[model samples]
Target: MLLSVFSCNSEPSIQDQMVDNPGDDGQNENPDEGEELSYKEKAFATYEMIQQLYKKGDLYKENFPEQNGDREYSYLWPYVGMLTAGNVLYELGYDREILDKQFTGLEEYYDNRDYLPTYQAYPVSGGATDHYYDDSAIVAMELINAYELTNESFYLERAKTVTDFIMSGEDSRMGGGLYWFEGQSDNCTNGPNCMKAANTSAYAAYVTSKMYQLTNNEAYLTFAKRVYEWTYTTLRDPSDNLYWNDINIGSEQINTTKWTYNAAMMIMSAVNLYEISDDQEYLDEAVTTARSAHSKFTKVTNGRIFYPPNDSWFNVELLTAYIQLSQYDSKTKDYVEVFKDNMDYAWENARNNEGQFYEDWSGNNEGRFYWLLHQAALVEAFGRIAIYENQ
Candidate 1:
């Protein structure tokens, strides 16, 4: 059993909690005018580097014997990094075989017998039992994207199965929202860290909404609508009107703060709801939240970065949502440039000499390696921006 701590698209970005981007990542102050890499070039380069992290064999680490060195000491969310790249490739229609290989490797994260994804999986042991809901929700979301891109039943079916896993995490315990952990039984605890989190519920709302659109299942639609409603009612901070990170199950108190991914998930869910129902309210909600998230992060350090997650990995969801919102509504256009500027900062400053985004875009590069999700998130962000520009 390989154990490690790393932040991800939806997780705490590993050992560090989502916080300020810190000091100064100089790129914002000195936006590079003569950058060598274009968005497309950065996307391709980062995309390829993330794929290289996938090795076929395992090894051992003396420090962490419990952890699988065989995985090259990598984690699960990085696999989602690969999926993000695959989804981008699929949307751009440039890669089929690579995406397929990504899907197969991603499947390694699933407990085939259980038909659901593990929180973190390795080459031999496969994955975990009690899982984080947000992690599985991301897998489901990517599968649906893959399914749409390829019209593959297997992707859709897997998406639905993972949806089942997400749904199982929901309960009325926290005044109605999905719990952060699922698959707890036989003395198991899925959410030992935090019982319910805003991030999990938000993504839960997103994947369910997308599944509703894909299968035309009213049950999914109802669940999607209900989950979205539940999250808003339960997690929305009444004072500032921005979202908080989670509810403290011990006290049943809302953790009165925000994270970029939380807002991103809500943005995507609301936009999707608008797509299916043509409801102006959903669109409006999405725009409002998008603007709020942008405001929270942009005002931080001179509009330099729109996400302050200690690890910029989670910024992927927020950036994609911002781009999607901009595509869907003109009111969100201004935020698009903010995201572009941030990406520019990342490309100019965060990427190492080897050309992969490390942890945080604060211009202080810590060469720890093993940040596949970190790099791929930026790749997906750039790829989506490129696609948006072409249109």
Candidate 2:
């Protein structure tokens, strides 16, 4: 079973652990001082940093420079980055032991409470946390990637389980979109009530479409197109072709906040649909959205391109979309290069003494504490960029 993974450690303590070859400041060594590291090298360095700081046994903690003695494991959202990074590392030909260990770590977050077992936001050891559909969808998508790479039935079975739960959130209230959270209120159709978010809806489409590709199941593709059409029609902004955050189902007012990942997920949905259906229109839609997203979110800094500021993981999602789109549209190659330059610059400038990445990729602001998700984001980005460059 997915739940039978790793045993919890007896109270994690930073003082109790030992790291090899530490610097004077008790951090891992960077590549000399001024020497620029390759994308793979940078990825490896950051992965080591993650292990040194965030890891408690096979599972990862929520933050680095441990805040409390509680040693809280990372929430399902942030741990998605780690799962993504592990998949990327598997692509880069990392050891099977390393990849399997990360998979074992993820089993810690699996929750099998009701009929459809899914990964909860926080581990069961930390008490009950809300199960977000988007979180489980993202993890399932990564598991799909793992299945594609390794041909593992375990990965596929777990992915199908989480995706089954994700599909359970879909309804006809907002014209067939998945709710952001698992359970809905009594009158979700009235007043200022629950939201049907682009992230949840579009990712549900992306996951189901990929599942169709893997299994050749018509049911997956049917749900994929249903949710994709709903999200595209409901949340998309006609003005810029970028996506809004979500639609408040009760008030029927759209949240106009444009997040990088929201648009990226839609792009992914289009790409998956095109690949599955062999439809030129879906390909065109993906290309158009990729162009708009690159223009909307990226900016030129100094001599190179920089990704969107803050929410580093959002940019990582965008990068993933660009890498996938680059196969069809050569223009997205330039978009991927922009992310490459930005990650390289961040490695040189935005890192703390302990080699932890600050949320700011521009290197202008100094962050006192680094987030585990931010570091995991960069590790995934670097590994992904390295794979793209090699291709």
TM-score of each: 0.82, 0.88
User: Please, what are the lDDT tens digits per residue for candidate 1 over residues 265-301?
Assistant: 8888889999999999999888888777777665445
| Candidate with maximal TM-score | 2
Q: Which stretches of candidate 2 lie over 4 Å from their true place?
A: 1-32, 67-71, 185-193, 367-369
Give per-residue lDDT, candidate 1, residue 62: 16
lDDT of each: 0.65, 0.76
Judge candidate 2 against the unseen true structure and give its global Cα lDDT, from 0 to 1: 0.76
Q: List, residue by residue over 1-391, the lDDT tens digit for candidate 2.
A: 0111112322211112111212123232344468767888778778888888888877887666654443457667677778888888878887777678878878777887867788876677777655678878989988998998899899998888888998988977868787766544224664332767788889999999999988898989999999999988888898888988778777888878788888888888999899877999899888888899988887876666777667788788999999999999999999888887787777777777778875667775544225577788888898988898783
RMSD of 1: 5.2
Highest lDDT: give the candidate number: 2
Q: Worst lDDT window (10 residues) for model 2? A: 12-21
